[model samples]
Target: MLVKTFRGAFVCTALGLALGVLYGGWTALGVVAILAVLEISLSFDNAVVNAGVLKKMNAFWQRIFLTAGVLIAVFGMRLAFPVVIVAITARLNPYDAVHLALTDKDRYQQLVTDAHPAIAAFGGMFLLMIFLDFIFEERDVQWLRRIEQPLARLGKVDMLSVCIALVVLLVTSFTFATHAHQEGGVHADKGQTVLVAGIAGLITYMIVGGLSGFFEDRLDDEEEREQEAEEAAARTGRSRSAVVLAGRAAFFMFLYLEVLDASFSFDGVIGAFAITNDIVLMALGLGIGAVYVRSLTVYLVRQGTLDDYVYLEHGAHYAIGALAVILMVTIQYEINEVITGLVGVVLIGWSFWSSVRRNQALTAAEPDSEAAARVSVP
Candidate 1:
């Protein structure tokens, strides 16, 4: 099972390393390996969150995610995104931006760093919305009962998540973003930029997520109608299978996943400069890491890992909430990537341990319950 799941990841890793060596010999190879590890460590929770969404999609769409989606992630986000950011932030043409990225990597890196405030604000708020919506909605399984129970109850209030998110955006924009701008002495209207970017993030989440849910409901209704039609056909001795394509529902979900991935990649993209500024190397390394993440997501879904470990989703969301907070703080402060990665690992590890304990307790109780039932029967 492991081999079957990770086969593509292994292949990608080999090709990435080979490309790294061809690009700049042994030094580049080492950088590529480190970057790949860094991406995986930082994005483990992203895989979990993705699994939760991907499992709901059909096989054909899943293939699309693994294929076309990989191209977008590797090239579009890892390569083209930073170039576009540099182009916009530095007020350069697309050709010059590409040239700068290739010829003057230091300047390229600096411009991307200058653009960090808006990037952090946008990605932070989008991730915050994801975390907020998850925590607010009531679920049958609660990971942190003491906290989740109260939040779930409060979730009954209309638009509570949105309200809280807006408040956070406002406070951070006025305080951290303003302070960062003054400190950096670059953009005088940094606070305003942050505000607008954050709002754009919020609206993007609403439109993409809202459309996905809307179409999902439509798909469900259609499936129910199809099921009824099939039953009627069976009763009339003309039974036929009903095939419901994922259609628009899957498309929106795919779009949502890509946006979610881009948000998750923002930090990694910036942080990769700490290792090297070669955009090609960054794409190769991060691309390899992304393949492994996609593989892990597929593994989780196929193995029913989320179903078996009920609180895994809870932990992933909690980690996402922590990341969202970290991103917001990073608007003004420089946080260690090590710290960011550790937070996610620790949260997910803790949740997995809790799940195992719960399973053990249930297993232990089953025998006693069976014995009691036997005695009562007598």
Candidate 2:
């Protein structure tokens, strides 16, 4: 497993270097490396969150996620999405945008910066919602239950969070975003576009995510109810019912995991646009990030990391919340990618360390279980 993990990283590094050499040699290498590290650091929380969903997926889907999903992430969203965004926002033809980027690198960079605020806002709110939902929602943990019981019962105030973020974004976009305008007549109609884009992104995420959560909760309930039915039927002689129900439960779990993956990817796709306008660079950076994230998911699943580290999910969720706020701020204020990466790394690192400590404590408490079983065995 260790070898496999290292091999994947090596493959990505080689691909990056090759791309760099083909593009601009040493300059491109520096760009890819810097972007790779920045993306990896900023997206560790994504790995943590992904672990939670990936646990429920079957091996086949997991493989697909690693392979096809990387293509979507690295190339589709990273490279193509930025081009798409510029085409839509700037009213430029897609081919024209591509031509501009390839020929006039400086102009292309400027266009990318102009397009960032909306992208940032979209990602920011998406992440914020993840955090708020996680923090406020009920968990299986006894301690978390005690702390979040009131908030969980009251339900997530997502609308309120969106409203506040919008108000702030509008204020900042009016003031700071105007100041940031440069030589090109790329004056974004900050008022209407910011509100529409931010709200649209927020609403789209909420609808999809909320529907996904609703179905998931219903599935959980159905599983429990079916199990009870199976138990009751077992008293008579209906073994077949239990097997059928179990199969249904498994299918439901698969659907749930896919929806969850989509939710997690929403912010990541938008966030990719914030770094570079060069579709190639964006794809390379985000693709590398996706590879590591998927690898980490596989690691987490095989090792049962989430089951072991009780608070790791919580920490990741908190980081998600922070990312949301940062995204919102970026609607008006241009956040440095390096800072974003550092924040994510710090949060995830803290969670990892905490989980390790908890696992050690758990091991210490169960010190004699292995020995006890060994001594009793023939």
Candidate 3:
């Protein structure tokens, strides 16, 4: 499993090194290595959350995730996305954006950074929705019982997450519109750009989720399910395929995965600018790390790790919440990527420890609890 999980990551590293050397020199290899580590640390929680979605997909879509999805994640978001954003923000042609990135890297990165508020608002709101929806779900196994239970109850309200997100955006964009701090003489303003971007993000979440849900439900309707059940019975639980190979459902799931990847990349892209404004280097470095993250997501799904660690999703969502707020705050200030990475690591680590303790308690109590039950029955 270790070899299987890391094989792609190793390959990506080798490519990164080769590309690094070609792009610059031996020193570029070191930069790529650092950026990969930074991206991995910051996105560990993303892998966990992705597993929750990916497991529902069949083997074919899973393969696509490794193959096609990797392309979207690495190049689509890590490379082309920044270029596209620069083009849109600066009103430059896509060709000029790429040219600017390749030649005048500093100006390109500045343009990207100058678009941070809108980027932050969009990504932050989407991620906040993910976090809110998770925490508000009425699950039997609660992590922060006191707080989670109330949030769960509040989940009964329709669009609750959207309301909360909009409220926060309104306050941030208005309250700090003029007072936005300066970075390298660039002002962070919360105006139409931020609001429009945020709403766009919110709408994106709804549309993606709705489309995926529609297809998923149609695929699992009662009649088709019974047919599947009958087929399974005839073949000892091995059912026939039905457009399941990158099917409609899988297609929507692909879109969802891409959007999710974009959200996660939003922070990494902007943050990478702070470290190194070179788009080529950022793409190579972060792209390597992004592949490893996808690898980790697949590993978690195959291993059923989420089932073993019940609170793991909880921790990941919490990390997302923290990241969402931090992303928003970062629009007006510079935050160390190390701090961002550390916060996620802490939450995930603490949840892992809690899972270990829970398992131990269950194991320790089994014998005594069974004995007591037997005695009572007699």
| CA lDDT of each prediction against the hidden true structure | 0.90, 0.66, 0.84
Judged by lDDT, which candidate is best?
A: 1
Write candidate 2's Cα lDDT for 308-339 as tens digits.
Answer: 87778877877777776777666665666667
Once fitted onto the true fold, the runs of candidate 1 whose alpha carbons sit more than 4 angstroms away are: 180-187, 240-245
Model 1 CA lDDT for position 313: 90
Candidate 3 has an lDDT of: 0.84
Candidate 3 lDDT tens digits, 318-351: 9999999998787677788889888998999999
Better of 1 and 3 by TM-score: 1
Error of 1 at 17 (Å): 0.4
Residue 6 of model 1, lDDT score: 90
lDDT of 1 at 125: 95
